[model samples]
Target chain A: MKLSIKTIIPIIVILTACTDDIINNDASPSNIFRSFWEIMDERYVFFEEKGVNWDSIYFDYQPVFDTVRSNSAMIKAFDSILSHINDKHLSIVSNDGHYAGMFLNDTLHYSISFGKVYSTYDFSNLQTYSHLHLAQLPEGISYIRILPGLKKINVNDLNIRQYDYSNGLIIDLRDCTGGYMSGYNFCSIFLQDERVVFYKQTKAGKGHNDFSGLIPLKIKGENIIKKETPLIVLINRNTYSMGNGIASILKENTNAFLIGETTGGGGGSVMSVLLPAGWSLTFTQSKHYNLARKLIENGINPDIENIPLIDFWKEEHLDTGKDPQIEIAISILQTTK
Target chain B: MKITLFLILIYLGGSTLLVAQEEETKSRGTLHNFRFGIGPIAYKNYYSIPNGLAGGSMSFTYQMEKEHKTKKRDFLLRANFDYSYLENSKVLTTSEPLFRRFKIRLGPGLLWPLNLKNNQLHLQAGGNISFYGEYIYPTESGGKHIYHPIPYGNWSINCNALIVARYQAGRITIEESLKVAIFTAGFFPEFQYTPTSIDNSYYWDFLKINTISTIPNYRMIENKIAIYFPLANNQTAISWRISYNHYNFENSQKYIEHNLGVGIRF
Candidate 1:
């Protein structure tokens, strides 16, 4: 049959369109996996430091992926590849932008009441600490209340730079929803050694920016600091992110006691991305590791487990009693040689 | 004139009754007899970036059983839409390159089944019309930041035909659909078909690296068959499909998306 231009072009178009369709489909395992890896490898800010080889990993996994006859199998294979990185943060976010097992938290309220507060030694009535409150127990344990920001106390300004670690220190990390890792520098004065407190894991190429290993406690000029002092850290549900990181560090490195509720489970090395969609995706690129190699995704369970002091004393209604949890730590410290 | 009038009256009367019979017969069949579906939507683009982007969409459908003469054949229709986009950074932000299409779309086709009840087997074929739309190019330093309307200059349309088969039991149904389109014909002859709009104007640009390159051809191509499942009960129905989409331009493939939402049937 002599094909007319109308029939010929459309016939050719049909065949050509079929070929093009085959070329651009996105559900193939190789393409799906490669696209995922490509986005992470190209966009993750710390690809190199996290030790990922995007291309080789994709190549190695592609055949295995192609062999998978089912989507369940494909997902299992993908997960296996992800787990190999040992990162909690590296994960496949659903197209809708929510991670599995993550929930938004906006609970826990703390009040600030204090006996005294100051910033400098010249001590002009000590400008009351904003965003931070101070509380002192009759038993000599002092409480510094802070939110997400760093609550720094220069060791020299503790008034006890002149005195030694005689009395136990109670750092109230309760109500702290988390802030910068720099907060650890100010909080580490009570630690004795540079110890691995946590490890962060990430897929080598997919945007896993991990803290690598435990944040050790190393004071300037001094090899050993607060070696004999018994430290007690307080936490509650409000503690999150780096707040949990701090608690984990202290738990692994010092003789500190943790009091209050388990922390929010926000453990993961984050790779922050400014997507073309305008919002940011702070993806979990790595899993968190304690010095013991134990992953700490669920926030740390406290050592003493006390409710907030105000609630604990709700029945007594007394303004001047010892915080029972802090009292317990002091009791334990008083007996320490 | 009297004879002509009589014939016209007879023809009009016959057609009116035929249409009425078709409607009456169609209403007799149960609405949720057999479920059918198509692959999800797909999009690929690159008029502004280095390697372009690509993805896909999927859906499911259900047809009523034969209730009257109109529903006797168990005929039902299926639909699909797919596309790809590609961009090159080598082209300067300002000077108009040999060509640029901010975004392009190539699908939204239909399918019909010959039989939907006997062992859930059927012979099927349908057609689709694919068209392209415009996209805005991003600005650059020392380059003019402006918006120019091409008014379908880069826009073109292609036609498609597909073969499909399906199986259904109770509330569960599985289906596969294969398609061929004229737009696919004009692409790479060996692997893809090129559309008329793409003919001669852009080809082999990806093979050569220049100060500017055409968007990758892979984004405009379709690479895999798709599976569709339409789930239904009393109050709500949904179609879920999954397919592989690819872009040789970016050397990437993605099992991106395939899902649909449908209202409940009585």
Candidate 2:
């Protein structure tokens, strides 16, 4: 049979070039193990800094996974291995609706109340928006309480410009769960000129600790808070991820004094992968550091650690009078005003 | 040096074969092959979209091939278009007919035949301007999607290369379709889409909040084994095909689909 030119040319090209690695769609235990091991092996960027000998991890866990039969068991097994590395961004959620999100949050907990603090501040005028609470407290002071899991709260809508005349601004991030670091750079406005708030080093090459040149992260925008307003940022143990990113920026650039407990450090972003066993797992691939280039996985600290002892307050049978942290913030603002 | 000599020998051998095939090349005629077919598609996802069996799936394809006799070898021009849809079921989508994906590919290819015994082994490789869109249908559970009528779409170029081993013994016709690089970039947007958050009221409103990374980055492998049943005319025949589609996207998307479809080829 005479062959056509269309058939002959493509055949030679394909035959000349050898194809590598066929797509693996198998959902068996072996395939699942291989996918997990290989994906982490190739993509996990913090292997060196994390100090986990991944090769040994694979060798030790590879055999163990062969014995595991169920998705839940495999998820737990993978979690056990990943737990060796300390990264808040790492998480795993099984297809059966089992989430490993809470497992990775480091053992640090804190709670605060906007209602309690509001009564303590005794603001003359107060306003509430979607995710914002603003108070025009007496003595030329503007107190803004921002809560966690914030949605698209526009800074322009915040009427932050109105506070240009105010003597001080309080950005309360207490008890807030972290979110994306995209919106509301109201604190950056206080910084007059360009300022390097942090430094970012990404894994550019394959080797352990093979990082890119330390790139300075400037307070991203212009002086949004044009006035050099004496700002007080309230933070506690729960301030996390994007909140931490914001707190780090404010600490480095603004005159804002962070008064509360330390933050929950989740500096890196979350990246996820799916296993052949119909399970999804997430882990942090990059490492983020403060402008000082210090690993921020360890949360940022407050300028003045006036964290009120909850136990002391409980023993005294007092609500607001014994809360040292709130009193300290009010005293400082009062003096500044 | 040895490899260079080996390549030289191949060149000389090809030259001799061309000289010997001058008469046969002159005798070959212009050939045309055309095919139109339709089948069903199944949808599944564990990444951006909810995963489960779809309500229904439909697929259609039309291809035209031309072989113009040339001096060096036979030159070929091929163009084909494929469209497929996988309807959303309530279990995965929350809303009845939650969403559906429509993909269309239009491409022209160059075919290379590489056998002397009936020359049954053929390979075709070419690029296609691909258009893929997943439209979210409105159902209860709130505000309409931000992308309203425009299905979240990613238009990109794709390279498709396939091997066809056609064996015709008297009346029996067999073909094995080994296709590599069959447009695996569906889940990946052509550009970086600003990440959004997910809320209950407006579900697929790409303009808002996001709790997870639903963007799919795919690596796929496709294989089909088809047999054609001959009719009275030799050119027209009915084909029974069983194809396997392996979809691997990021870590959240992995599913294998075994498809069975019947169509006529001319």
Candidate 3:
């Protein structure tokens, strides 16, 4: 059949003329308020963990949402509800761009504490790369500090097996905060043996407690870390989210000894949403558990809870009576190897 | 609201079409013939869920036929893309969360004409790079939709091939050319290649595969049945076509939809 372009052109024009968006972008104030609350009502996984009365919340927030004449007011209403939830990942979305950050403020000096650890090695002389800090101590302990919000590191880049440590290696995750825990499994240098790393559960229904059967997440051991090579992983209260996830995994999968205080437990994997006001919100969609089946949503305790002294911040660890975590780690490694 | 507007638009377009504009006749065997058309349809649609959810569907197609006067079959190249989506334009929350399934195919095939008694029939077998995806989103009334940092959104993709057959004919008896008209129907089977676990989160590092990434034995099946009538003068520029589609992707997702559309056959 011979079809003419002259006839087809008009058909194409008429057909393509509709400017309707495939996904309806409805931005009405009431829709925004209702959708935001409904999305949270059905999607947030931490409701059971938090113990808040969701019904009362809706009743409380519905009135607030009713008063929202502008995006800023909408953001404020969202902030009021999210603040009560007190979850690390729960973020309310808006189309107009204001977020929870504009309201929530923290006074903790985690950065200063992190700086204290950096001073252990000459800040200027430390070998640095993407999200990684590797410094070989004269005591033969290879010092590696992973920063917050970093992704998986390539094994080839680390060449972890090539490092000759007479006193083993120290993976200092003092305040490491972000990224995926499963992502860092590429650093297989730490996997000691075949082990059940963790478990993950995703939401399946509208019920707040509704969840799918546990998906057994595992990591098999493969490597050449000699028995004589000792490993010491350090953690503190600020070691949260992915950092805590890393700590819990190492505690279960590796022979690495943990020193320092407990980790900051924030084990919920995140899910995101966008509001009619144009703000992007995120919150925990699933719960993660360690092999022991503990919701690492709370911090995990270290093997040896050696608290680093305040004076340890004044100078390097070599200063006796200071830096008890490092001193204990080195002594433990010396005796073990 | 948007759906009512769309229906009105479809009705307007259907009413404005020049059904009697073109005359129906056998092709003169032009080595290359180009065509394009659009239409509205109604179909049962489901993504990730078991039961079919009914919805308004749309289909678009563009094709070209190549053959010589002496050839028994024509080399046919065609691209077809269709979608079935469910939404409540008025109550965004009660909306079925935009359960959408998209089927697209483009490639070349051989269309062989069958010289039956007073009938013009064609058998088509083609190898197309077919891509099918059923996206499941969590949405609610009032236009509430889940967005970025989405921990749980399913994107099932299947890439495969298919076969089709259609019959179109002119007035067979000289007595009544318009009493009863011939319609066209086609059936196609697709072998799907899909992945089981692809954590396609926007936050992941792409260059390196995440350790948890698992590729399991995944299978998908798709079959389509279509019937179209040449409403005016045998040139189906105006026709009522109904298409039935059954798509199964692994055990987690399956869809069956019956679509009735008015299309302009080029």
Candidate 4:
């Protein structure tokens, strides 16, 4: 049978309209989440290691899910929450993770490459180091410069991997937006106390946990080198989420002196959902804490506030080869300790 | 409300078109035909007596067209029925009466068609005569009641002169026309006396009720002036006819009602 011209045209028009609707309809989560959940449940290698109850996990989380209202907010929430996990190997991979710094974006990726370290007063010479930069100033103070969350560099790896620390150490967190909270994993190299390592802030309030035995780094296969080296940590406004979190951990338990700008205020552990529409959303799962639930959302402030070194970099056109705030720690070690 | 009734008329007309087509082949050359239709209907009347008044009627449409030998001109005879009622309630507190009335019309006209690509232009002009068929009135006295009906005929007349232009686009053709009808004289004794009472002064109020003698023995004439636009094609088309009908009673009272109808061409 043959169709008339009039019938054919209307049929074509109706089909085109239906196709338009199909393309525009957003994919709902119900379709994508089930398969993803099934795959992870059956095949994830770390399913047993992480001690995660995959089935109960979905059921418990499903009822409390809220739709992400905006994209930017989702990214921010994702970055903050992922940073709180404190495991160097685990971190959210996204384009926004580059907030740590332009140089960090280049160097800090999933894999770690060990290289020579150097430091300079001028940031314009940062590329000169080509690897991590370690600066020794006028005093017995040492500065270790690098952005966090850009690498899978665990503290155990660092402790085992040879590095000399003869003077008071200055850890720079300026412009360090944040990454995994595992900075405390290497604390044993300088801190010996097992009292308070960090604070985990949940809805119920603050809970203190000791990382003293968490990352056990064994040196020479015999003794635990618990170096009580006096530490001075430097932070700036960009010392966000996990950066502030680690700083809070160090401040309460160790001899670390916090200096320079106040840390970025970002509390809560983030929960993320990969939407069926190929979009992702991240939200705060729980609150944050400092000392006994002191200041949940408010960030960690420094012992002394110093002018942001970026201001001087802007004024003098001298891009410090490393975080100048960390240079401040090296300078403080020369004068005070 | 008038438009609603007109839609029902068209719906019934649609079914009639299908039924009528079965009996008659598409008429060729010159043709004249009449269409009769009716449907189940119920509505509240607005007369001063029986408030809920419900009734139905058979509508008639007649169209006659003849092609001229020399020119593409055609003479057409058309007729339509405009039936309605205004019913009121039994004597509750207001000692007013209630009644219902129906109107009908017939028109004859000529048309000139100009051929065009994808459409046709038609210029048509026509005139018509219209009147009521019956009037029913009910009276009440505190505890007593009475009912009555009066046969009314050929009460109003109107001469409609319309110049319409029509265009056919595929299955749809649209026509717009201007019409002006002048009221002639009534058909009964109503063409004589003039009453000044408020109730009788308003021709519409009296036309709405039913009374034997009180049904004024006067001429009820109407003049309609309007612009009508109808879009239609071979199978189906929607016609929107908007017109103003003015009533002139011998009682020296004048009233006007607006009319609109959506019709389908067979």
RMSD of each: 22.3, 12.1, 10.9, 34.1
Tens-digit lDDT track of model 2 for B14-94? 323332332111122544544554544344443233232233344454555455445323344444344444332212212
User: Candidate 1's residue-wise lDDT over A217-280, tens digit each?
Assistant: 2333222335666677877776776677778877877777898789765565343322221111
> CA lDDT, every prediction?
0.42, 0.51, 0.51, 0.40
True lDDT of residue A270, candidate 3: 65
TM-score of each: 0.36, 0.59, 0.62, 0.33
The candidate maximizing DockQ is 3
RMSD of 4: 34.1
Which parts of model 1 have CA positions greater than 4 angstroms off? Answer: A1-139, A151-165, A207-225, A307-337, B1-266
lDDT of 3 by residue, A1-337 (tens): 2232245336334433421212224556666667666667766778888887888888888777666687777777777777777776676655433466311332123332444445654333366767777776645667777787566556457655445577788888886765665455644566656556787776666678767777666665456455446789988767777778888877777677899887767786664544433445576767788888879886789889976554454444434224557667767776766
- The residue ranges of model 4 lying beyond 4 angstroms of the native Cα positions read A1-119, A122-139, A150-156, A159-164, A193-196, A201-228, A309-311, A315-324, B1-266
CAPRI quality level assigned to candidate 2 from its DockQ score: incorrect
- Model 1 iRMS: 19.6
lDDT of 4 by residue, A1-337 (tens): 0232244235324422332222212333333334234423422223332355556656744432235444344444434433433222222222222121122332122121112114244222222122234554434454565464432233444432233345676676655555533333444445444444434432211112111111111111112334466678876666665666667766875678899767665543443322223332233323445655464345688897876444444444233333445556667676654
Angstrom error of the Cα, residue B133, model 2: value is 10
lDDT for each residue of candidate 1 in B148-266, tens digit (9 for 90 to 100): 11111133344555565443333333333444434332221111111111012234532332211132433333322222234453423332333323334322222233333333343
Give DockQ for candidates 1 onward, in order: 0.01, 0.05, 0.11, 0.00
CAPRI band for model 4:
incorrect
